[model samples]
Target: MNNQQWTGWSSGAQQAEQHYLVEPRYLAGGGNLHHVADFLRASGWSDKSKTGGPLVFDSPDKSVRIGYDPYTQPGGWTISANPADGQEAWHATFTRQTPVEIVAGFTDALTRPRSAHAPNAWGPLQEQRWQTEQGQHFTAMSPDGGAWLQYHQSQPGQALWWAGARNEHGRIWDASFTASTPMHLIESFSAALADPQQVMRPRGHVPPSTRIRTTSVSVRPDELSAWQQARVTAARAATWARASWATTRPRHTTATGPHTQAGGRTRR
Candidate 1:
């Protein structure tokens, strides 16, 4: 069930369109560029964008690159880490449908430097009861089998990681991280994958091929949890802080004060 009022469409033509507000658990593929971009800017990344082209950012040391291009097929957002010697290191990409919060899980951990010891990539997913098979290869799938995360040995010393969702028809969207991708980064992605928060979608706008597998509820504004309410408050506060700072600071200034994750409190 969906609440028509929650659609937020004021135009008569838009109102006439059919939509259902669905809340998906595992395979919630969507993104918030503004949220992801803000986090990057705060992490000391520099923006190098043309007036009417793609959004691009470079790390402080020029070791990483992040881009958002509208015209790109399949995936619009790309992030890669490159070493100084010019050889490419690891990289991750996201289609427009991939949730930005999950992407943030990687970036946030990236900014906050951690110990060099490798963390288990499967730990977070295992906490959520996703089944895993470990051998010459590694694979994990959602309890319902709607989504999966896997690692494959691409070469003698190189490997690739991929995650995606599907239904009867075919694949929806997929994301990948190449070899040398930090284990902590992978762990962050796993934690986000196992998060309990559900993603909202318009029932009519959901993929035609996967619609039969969706699970939803009619959530009203009042139904949000206290923690979620606090996050909304923090987002409003951050927005206000950014606006006020813009008036007195340089154009490249980062917003100050309280910051909130894209959704509820991060599991990590």
Candidate 2:
């Protein structure tokens, strides 16, 4: 979907607190947001804040949002323990509950290639259909055969597998598979989503150690540019030095010098 529709999905109430973590799915419109807020209010979320917004539930212990944004993308909106200006504020990062099937699929996809019979698809997979065995119907949509859009639909209370694909040619497509264990998947994806860079770590951080770290380092635009340029120059210099060394290195020699002997005797 386009950006506006996507943002609407993010602003929906289904995204309230961390429920989106369990499902990690966004409603297509703002209506879901209202529905979520109403649900929270009915569920006894406090409206006593100065902003009169939903209160944090003790069980989950997280605030819920009750607002909208024009540029928010699906899976991008979040509720904080605090609110701003009598309205729900979205955090730059938030947590989600992981699903089991998604966890299984993600683990499987990473360790093994898709089965020969499985569809080699691309893009985040949406749940449209499923089989009793739990194997889902998937589709790959792309102009280049290198990428596709895919989805996996699982039995109820599962995670929808999702991600963008990359190859030698860069990112080619995004996709997701249905997950049987949603809570786990939500937990895992929420951690990744909160810190996109974490996924690039050699080994993922364990939950006990998954604390969010932030620094307030500030740099002027020019300083940032200079730092980037310095990095580029260093890389170029290293490449050039390696190439020069490769070209200048001496070649291997055979044992044909005076040190060589024909019958165990030195030949000078």
The most accurate candidate by TM-score is: 1
Model 2: weakest 10-residue lDDT segment is 20-29
**What lDDT does the true structure give each of the candidates?**
0.67, 0.30
Q: Which stretches of candidate 1 lie over 4 Å from their true place?
A: 2-26, 84-88, 115-118, 201-268
lDDT of 2 at 94: 19
The model with the greatest lDDT is: 1
Model 2 segments more than 4 A misplaced: 1-162, 165-217, 255-268
lDDT, model 2, position 67? 29
Local accuracy of candidate 2 as per-residue lDDT tens digits, 35-55: 223333433334433444422
Compose the digit string of candidate 1's lDDT tens values, residues 1-268: 3233433322233223233433344355564466667666655678888878888988777888888887767646788887656455888886776666677777666655565777988988888899998877799988768677899886689789988766667676677888678788889888877776655554455555444444443434333233244544554565467567758763332256455524444333
How close is each model in CA RMSD to the real structure? 10.8, 24.3
- TM-score, one value per model: 0.66, 0.21
Clashing pairs in 1: 20-203
The whole-model C-alpha lDDT of candidate 1 against the native structure comes to 0.67
